[model samples]
Target chain A: MTAWKEIDQHVKVWMNYARKLILAQIKTDVQVSTKSGPNDLVTNVDKEIEEYYVKQIKLFFPNSLILGEEGHKDSGMLKHQGYFWVIDPIDGTMNFVKEQENFASMIAIYYNGKPLLGYIYDVMKDKLFWGGPACQAVYCNNEKLNSPANLSLKDGLFGASCPMVLRNYRGINEVISKSSGARIVGSAGIEFINVMSGKLCAYLSFLRPWDYLPGKILAETLGLIVKTIDGEPVNVLSSTDVLVATDNAQSEIFKIINNY
Target chain B: MTAWKEIDQHVKVWMNYARKLILAQIKTDVQVSTKSGPNDLVTNVDKEIEEYYVKQIKLFFPNSLILGEEGHKDSGMLKHQGYFWVIDPIDGTMNFVKEQENFASMIAIYYNGKPLLGYIYDVMKDKLFWGGPACQAVYCNNEKLNSPANLSLKDGLFGASCPMVLRNYRGINEVISKSSGARIVGSAGIEFINVMSGKLCAYLSFLRPWDYLPGKILAETLGLIVKTIDGEPVNVLSSTDVLVATDNAQSEIFKIINNY
Candidate 1:
């Protein structure tokens, strides 16, 4: 078995270094460009940050497989029997370029296709929520995090993707209305963080691996359900509609989505 | 003139005191109740804070008219007003009771029907965005704030009340889709703050005087528009649909609403 505890310690150090670099770039002018469209943005910083994390991963775990949002694609490595890192350098690139807040950097690690460690860093707030099976505990900064209350849809707010809500995809509007309200912070990692913190009962979005991987690891560790909208396990190698919620919330959301 | 500068200075002191009281109550168990419906919330803190402000206003400006959300209804005072203070002790009371953040405490001073000064205190962040015509300046905390960029609807995010958007009132969904995205922070004061800070292009919602008063004063001072959807002035004593936005965004939003 891998020394997962030792790996967690090293990852924490790397993430701290990554945080410093991200903060340093916040004040400087960002070079922004669109990927899928104008609404879908990617920044030079995203590329640089992803490259930085990949470099760190490669240096520390030379044979590790890497899948990153900023165009690092080696899917074949996922099939290898070794450590694998899924990283989203800057999760909310649009927010990063526009609001300069609500964005996050996330990293998830797996060993031989089993979850190992996860880190979701709220860059602006300087909060690092990290943990996994190996660490045996979920934490925000140094404080251990409790499992979110199993709030029903009516008892808490929901986080949703704009396109999903605007289009009312799979009855998102109805699901949202059943909740206290909806929040759209435009960051998958931040949305996941909100779910884990009990600030949001659930977050549903069509997300890629890098977008949801770290959140999935951290959230599941805290006893929150992270799965596809169809109540299936999330396939961390493709884009899919994902739901991260407490037990009651997940069940309630699934019933709504299924009925629709 | 009403010695507006002196009044501003004193209001700041009262606001600081109010801030301290609000912060102190944040950690205590809150007594929550509903108004209008379950979605429209009120807390003991809201009542206490509004009463606190009213007491200060009555003590400091003995002849001032006071209209507050927490049942300090004295429309008669407006008629004989030397200074009218419109206050919403906790503008996003639901958010306050649920999230404990994003809500604001606001006070707007109008002298004989002319806007004089406004204060929107983001109690948690400790940011007091205040100023008006008499001051000839707007500020977030101590720093003088600049007018937001004249961003068009397509260039920035739009803030809308949930019901308005869910029902597509005034074609809000279309208007929001034209913007970068939609944000629903559930607090009119925070939405106005976002527009002034260039974080959101506009905020549209049905608001009473206490809800939109402070935001209107500060937004206008920053050269942003605060008016009704049909381009009429907002009536200070009644609930109406209010739009707060920069020049280009306001015009673009108007065009979309008018077309629909």
Candidate 2:
């Protein structure tokens, strides 16, 4: 196998192992605590999963840079000219604690600032959607996903952030009105999966690097659009409002956002 | 077995059969069309499922009055003193056509204006959550579900209607802000499942009789509150805004709506 193929194999194995750990933790009393606020929660499982990923990365590729949600941040690592991995130990921590479903674990790897492999695992469902530009096709497990039809905003469901929808931020209300309906799964990764699987036309939310990177990589590779509400490239380092959408939907949304 | 038990067994078998029919239709070319507007979608599969349910109900209970989402509407059936069946063969028709995952099939049986049983089957997930006050316990598949802890609005996720959240109607914005966060699944049956399964503390939406009745029956059996935004009892014969919530969350949400 080629170098990328080998890396893919190793990462897949690590993800499955991590899934086991996360599932095991749920069976026990999960140690939960507040972070920035009461709603912003972090559990012992999140930390353990992140630490597990960091340890594996260090052992396999010592020179690699890691940016993880639960710590393990190498500032300015996006500029690093080597293996760089972005990990969200558990996306939608609230959903994990509350629903125990609709949450995901994601990892995005970049080689010398270029997209490599991207993986987002719906841990409970045991469905791993992973691929990148290198593979030339995204796969939900072994079946490669076809590029979704370029559905317009009016033709598909639009995923929105609850706060954005509530506040009508950036003409989101107008955008939602144009779509068939709005859905909020409260997990960026799962929402991204919805779009990637041709289930949703677009997904918009304020997201961090680790939250958006894996989905962004997989989405863009499938001929989807990932950018800011203003139609600008998203900075990999900053937390900002991001929109990942189908081509036709992106154009339709831009019309609404620009009017706002 | 008791009369209710026999009915439950037969209903479970019918639901599994309907699930098979629906899944089979998805594998073929689904016939889709609009109702009311382009956003309000219905499919041949939806009609077929409803027809199947009606046939089963009529065969088993010949005197039953059926109120179904597709076509079978026995007017003023809620006042009927015999078996009254409410069938939403496919709830979340939009989701069924667009996502094929989040939608559900629901059947609510009432006898002499009293709820006897409710069944909501998440078709794709193959999970059947069915029960009533008659059963004294709701069961997801074979496992009995406990009544969720009465979480306050600040302690759990709240499910909201897109339009309500968008317009901030009825002070939904204030109610959502008080909750840990907001979620919109676009399927009343599924949202009710979330609440029934202790995943969401509350779910609010504007729904017709078929849209809300099954969930209402099931949710009330679990000691959850189901009422209008004004804290009034929900009528079984009309379309209105409904709220199904945990006891504590119901009180908290009523305070927000009252203040509004």
Candidate 3:
């Protein structure tokens, strides 16, 4: 098998193992803690899942570097050659803690600074959306996903960040008013799935590296556009307002944002 | 069996049958149509599901009056001193047509102008949230659901209508800013499930009787508050801005709306 195919198999196995760890503890009492502020929650499951990924990556591929959501970081991984992985084990910690649904676990792999493989596991739904430029197509489990319809903003539901919509940040409210409607599922991974699946035309939010990268790789592979709100390329390591959308919606949203 | 118990059983069986009809047709080409506007969608599956429920209700309880989302209405049934049923063959028509997920089928039963039973089946998830004052407890399938904690405005997530949040209707933006965050799922039945399950502290939307009745019945039965934004009694036969929330969140939201 090709190296990419072998790595893909390993990542899927690790993700499913991480999924079990999360589901096993979800029904029991979750040890909840706050990060940054009261509303920014992180549970014990998130930490354990991330730790498990970090350990597995190290065990399976000793040369690979890692960046993880729960404080696992390799300071100079980006500069190194070979495998570099980004892990968001239990994205949407708030949803995981409160609803135990609508959350996901994700991994994005880059080889020598090129996007290679991505995996996003909708933990509750048990749907794994994985693939990248290397694999040449994205999949929701065993089914390969066709590119979503090229819908404009007005033709599809828009997914907005709560803070952006609430504060009318950059005139997002104006943009929302022009769409069919808005949906805020509160999990970036789920929102990404919506855009990739043609359920939503676009999703815009302030997202950190781990929050946006896996979805970015998969979405772009499916012929969707992933970029900064300003229509510039997104910095893979920085937190910024990222927008993943159909080509038509990206142009429409850019028009609104530039007008704002 | 008691009359109410028998009715509940019948409704459950009928809802499951409706669910099957919906699932079977969901993957095939859905015959799409519209009502009121382009965004207001209805599919042949929706019509089929409602027709099935209406037929069953008429067959089993010949005296029961029916009001359905897809043009099945029995005028003056509110005045009848017997069972009155409201059916939304498929809630979240847009979601159903676009995402094929996050939508539901619902039924609300009233006796002598008083709410009796409510069932909201999340078709894609295969989970039915059903119960009423008659049952004395709410259930997700077979397990009984406990009342969600009475979280205050800042302690929980807030669910808002896209238009309401966009227009800042009655200062809903202010209320959203005070909560942990805002979520807009665009389906009243799904949002009601979130609030009833304590995933959200509140959900506010302008809904028709068929849109809100089933959820209002289930929510109120679970020790949650269901009322108009102004704290007035929700008229069961009219369209209005309804709020379903925990006690503390309701009071906090009412204060904000009143000030607005």
Best by TM-score: 2
Instruction: Specify the highest-DockQ model's number.
Output: 2
Residue-level lDDT for B3 in candidate 1:
85
Candidate 2 structure quality by residue, lDDT tens digits, B1-260: 13899899889999999998988888576999998899888999899889998999899888889999998888768678788999999999998889988899999999888999999999999999999977888999999999989998888999989888878888889989889999988899999999987789999999999999999998999999999988999999689999999999999899888988
For candidate 1, list the clashing residue pairs, or say none: none
- Candidate 1 residue lDDT tens string, B20-83: 8778887696888888876778888888888988998899888888888999977675566588
What is the lDDT for A142 in model 3? 98
Cα error, candidate 2, residue B71 (Å) = 1.6
* Cα-lDDT of candidate 2: 0.91
TM-score values for chain B across all models = 0.96, 0.97, 0.98
Question: Which candidate do you rate higher for DockQ, 2 or 3?
Answer: 2
Clashing pairs in 2: none
**How many pairs of residues collide in each model?**
0, 0, 0
Ranking the candidates on lDDT from highest down gives 3, 2, 1
RMSD (Å) of each candidate, 1 decimal? 1.5, 1.5, 1.7
Off by over 4 Å in 2: none
Report how far residue B40 has shifted in candidate 2, in Å.
1.0
